[model samples]
Target: MAATLPQDIKLHTKSRTLELIYSDQEQFELTAEYLRVHSPSAEVRGHGIGNGVLQTGKQLVGIKGLEPAGNYALKIIFDDGHDSGLYTWEYLYDLCQEQENYWNRYLKALADAGETRHGNMIAKG
Candidate 1:
């Protein structure tokens, strides 16, 4: 089967979310914190099985910028200085489909590891 492509991509920095539209009329809005921690980079995913890193403290992270990685994926730069992940159309779709499950798992892992989301948002003081 052939892969589906995204018809449009919009990064709303103010809302810190990525909006993707596909030719099939499917749309998704993903948050920057979710994308950052779930990045498929070696830094997070590692080079082999069981090498994935546990990311913490990204509750308030925001997208700094986004670049197209050829015609297949998006290169997202997070405000926390992470810019290695390539978000492909298929992957993004999967994320949208399983967002709730993934988020629950992330939260559980953080709790099990005695960690917390150290978001980048500053307190209005």
Candidate 2:
């Protein structure tokens, strides 16, 4: 059975982002770019783990629309033409709680892979 979601849901909008709060006291400030890159949709995360595509050049992306998916999730449409991630309440809470650690790890992974998130570096011939 699925876990019960929080009773109260709140959303706050910033200049280019949205913050979601749950009744369980968990919160997430989802930047447009972060949401776009980390979308749970097959297009972004792929069919399974380790199949996620690296998304770059979306530092300024923002949310263009939001739709409710019953009581368990939300559908987010981004300005960059991505709109398939169904963000569950629990999953979103986890993302908020783990954003800092996840972001740091992502940065480290990019470095280890000799990659730049901005896509400005060029390979030498």
lDDT of each: 0.83, 0.69
Cα RMSD of all models vs. native, in order, equals 2.7, 6.1
> What TM-score does prediction 1 earn?
0.86
Best by TM-score: 1
Q: In lDDT terms, how accurate is model 1?
A: 0.83
Off by over 4 Å in 1: 1-3, 23-25, 119-125
Error of 1 at 36 (Å): 0.4
Per-residue accuracy of model 2 over 1-125 as CA lDDT, tens digit each:
14335444444334556776553555556676666667888997778879887776666666777888997798887766788889987777677778888777767776777766664423221
- Per-residue lDDT tens digits for candidate 1, residues 73-113, read 88998887789889886787788879999989998999999
Model 2 alpha-carbon drift over 4 Å, by segment: 1-14, 23-26, 113-115, 119-125
RMSD of 2: 6.1
Candidate 1 has which clashing residue pairs, if any?
Answer: 57-118
lDDT of 2 at 56: 68
